[model samples]
Target: MTPHMSRKTRIAGISLAAAALVAAGITAGTAGASTVQAPTADGSPLKLSASHRAELLRDASATKAQTAKELGLGSQEKLVVKDVIKDADGTTHTRYDRTYAGLPVLGGDMVVHTAKGGAIKSTTKSTKKSVKVASLTAKIAPAAAAQSAQGTVAKSLSAKKADAQAPKKVVWAASGTPVLAYDTVVKGVKKDGTPSRMHVITDADSGKKIFQYDDIRTGKGESEFSGSVDLGTSKEGSGFTLTDADRGGHKTLNLGNSESGEGKAFTDEDDKWGTGKPDDPQTAAVDAHYGAAETWDYYKKVQGRNGIKGDGKGATSRVHYGKNYVNAFWDDDCFCMSYGDGEGDKAPLTALDVAAHEMSHGVTAATANLTYSGESGGLNEGTSDIFGTSVEFYAKNDKDPGDYLIGEKININGDGKPLRYMDKPSRDGQSKDFWDSSTGGLDPHYSSGVANHFFYLLSEGSGPKEIGGVKYDSPTKDDKKVEGIGRDKAEKIWFKALTEYMTSNTDYKAAREATVKAATDLYKAGSPEVKGVEAAWDGVAVK
Candidate 1:
């Protein structure tokens, strides 16, 4: 079943309405509370306080129309405010999604930065070109587009019974020039029983395939990784349920080897749970529950994000997704994370990094909403990897110590190897270690190597180093030395970039600019941190 298949429209409306509420001095929960935190790295205050965010939103919403007109947007083009950020020096950056002639523009998202007095300072856009289509009429029927999309998915995945949903008209600007297109979602079950939600974009006028991507993001390989661990549970009747009240009521459910529907909630007579063995169903649940909590804490303490979507609401974690599924995924429709039992049901993909990796996808969806294809897709995956590694380090679990090696504990390769490496991504044989013209054409998992490598070099620097018993030897594409900026500052820069500067179609080059801008925002321009960001991108050949 395709979950939240038509979420784009809903998300757009919700964002606009939320902005309006903020503008009217009404906000969600304690989001409007006055709480200020010290700036990091001895830099200016980059953190947005509750009242500050509301004021920024109010100002942004009030000037939306004027800003669009000043930016030379078409008369029919409308801007919906998505987020607002403020600097201590009184500069404001507002992010928005564009709608042209009532149709969503895939790559028309942009960030408008203004000086203290409301004069435009600079702008960063996913596409610099204007968004205007000659006509809104589609010569091709939606049914034909859906059928064509289904055929593409069938050809790509070799599935027997792929079902197509009615295609919706959207302005496709992610690649080439802007054009009218049909966005079709095809649903089916992959060979391994994982639910498929392939998004295919076709030209509305000519019915030509434009772009496609799978919504079901997965992490390959699996192992019963998490050892004995503590779990947060709540009392129900005389027993305890695997529901964590401390962290947005996050709960773990048992799929019982099923492939569909909401699974049953795990309950125990005592508060204790799991034996660290896959034979017992509770073992996997224990890992999933613990992993979710760790990810939540990491985002809260490290990233200042209260929860996924920044709404302070918990998401469900489903364990034992399918029969020998061998993979895990996150579904926006369900707003939940699902895990599969590895081959033969002896190994589960509930490792710490895997859990953090999947959950970070939700965070990306909430913030940048990076298109899960092309360079943006690679950055999306890379973002998850970066935060997943960060969460692992923050947890500092002895059994699953943080390392640059991803999926190390899961043993997904079956040869006692990791799924990917950050220090040198090409160590996995399929990943690209540096950026090139053809990097965007590779699978996102492989293309993500560039970002993974950049983060490693930025955090640990080039050459050899050791941390927490894991050794790393990162190399620069340009054969230049880059001093480390430390992971704390590095993560902060990345979070700021992802939240404040990036848009849907931000490519590797755009990412470099966003991070530099983010570094400049958090640390003054010409600061060592800003220089370090530029050098790290250079080290990855993104320059």
Candidate 2:
């Protein structure tokens, strides 16, 4: 494979594919795309014509109303089967347009709708057949069906095959950190032709669903669904892979275990967002696709990193580590990442910026090795904050538009206020633009101020103006009119300094020096990067 030039985040937390690559010494950005071809679009048996879709939609309207009634909506739900899809993996996916009280309603969904269609064919006279199933769509190739299905129908595994010898990987949640226990899920008839056994390794923590296949009527079962997933039936040398599901190119998985059976967070695991979404892993998956792709493009097409670490490796994510685990973090034990669900209708923190933030953490780890304490630690946190905000601006999602405020829609504070404000760090009641040694004792999210201020100054020149929705104005201390070098140049300079010059023991002064070194490396000692680094820090009121 032609070597890619970039440092990329491992996909361990997001998909077993990225995780395995990191495990195999293929850092994120450097690993070139494999020659593996995509599966065929017509690979599965489930195909729906326009007429078939309309028929299902007609039936869906009435059944959804019944569902609404069951949910106590009382004959007020007007459902429209808006979409019916046969995913590339052969799973029948569906979506519905829901109207409540005859008002133009929203918040409907796309989901695995083909559970034998018991619910889609629902009627008041027959409660046994009705279901609240949703159908979805995915890009598939003809060969993809058989290729993806191979994981589920994978050749049998013996006790020897099931055993794995390696250092135990540790995972963190809100309540505590748990050692990763790997187990094989085997189900099927043995070679004796009795009940066959199919062995698949799992994280053994959440045992989340990875890939599935529908029992075929006459032939060997087809691969029903395949995508970058949190947990699955993959094995070395063969079987389903996240790469198998990467359709739009390099993909990312954002895990959050909630309604996961109920969107409930893991109580003992690190409450970060990454793995799977309890309410909807697909939504999380696709959304991550949007965010990760954007970040990848931001770095590659924009910042020039192959992935997170600039190694060209895809990133991984995990979510809902523990119940009510109201926090998130990243580390080297696993290149994978995750998120958590908030209270009520609130979802785990899967915003574009949040994903960007976690991915940025991977970038930070691979580069600066910045100690997560004191001013340097604050700078590390600030770097993530700034990049996270930049990525938000990158994706430009309408619902969650690019903004300087982190976790605004997540409602983490439960008071409708955002988690952190970049323009003015103090907006959240705790955060700083200037640094003091004591800032380390504060929340890393809070101590992150000095760096956050630095980034703000670098991007917009330490001022207050609204670029994307959430607004704030920053001020420089020394009456210095610091000019902006912009985020594009700042990211290049910060990341380079991080990976090439900064060390684990690097401090605040070291941070400055390393950035200067990076600036020198990128643009010759006194080029734009050098001047920009000086001016950006000055705007953050550092000078």
Cα-based lDDT for every prediction: 0.76, 0.43
lDDT over C-alpha atoms for residue 70 of model 2: 51
Off-target runs (Cα >4 Å) in candidate 2 are: 1-278, 309-312, 344-346, 524-529, 541-543
lDDT of 2 by residue, 1-543 (tens): 222222222323332111000000000100111222222232222334435545755665666656555544435445555434343343343444444344322122222234343533211110112222222121333233333333444443222222212211212110112212222333332221112223222223344322221110000000001123222112213222222122122433333433122222112122122343335444444344445555666665545445554434565555443444333344344564444433331344344555566667677665444545456556666676667666655544443444455554444345766556666677768777665556657645577766766666665665556564445677776657666666655665665555445544455555677677556645666666578788766655454
Q: List the residue pairs that clash in candidate 1.
A: none
> Candidate 1 local accuracy as lDDT?
0.76
Q: List where candidate 1 sits over 4 angstroms from the true fold.
A: 1-63, 86-92, 114-120, 221-228
> Which candidate tops lDDT?
1
**What clash count goes with each model?**
0, 100
Relative to the unseen true structure, what is the C-alpha lDDT of residue 453 in candidate 2, on a scale of 0 to 100?
66
Candidate 1: Cα lDDT at 265: 86
Cα lDDT tens digits for candidate 1, 1-543: 212111100001010000000000000001111223333443243444446566767878898999999999989999988777666677777888899988999888888988889899988888978788889999999999999999999999887568999898999987788999999999988776778899999999999999998887766532424455556677776667888777778889999989888999887765666665667787778777877888998887767666786656789999888887777888888899888776777666676666777888898887788988889989988888888777767776655445677665444445777668788889989888899999999888888899988887777789887766667788898899999777777778888888878888889999999899888877778888899999999999998
Residue 157 alpha-carbon offset, candidate 1, angstroms: 1.5
lDDT (Cα, 0-100) at 255 in candidate 2: 36
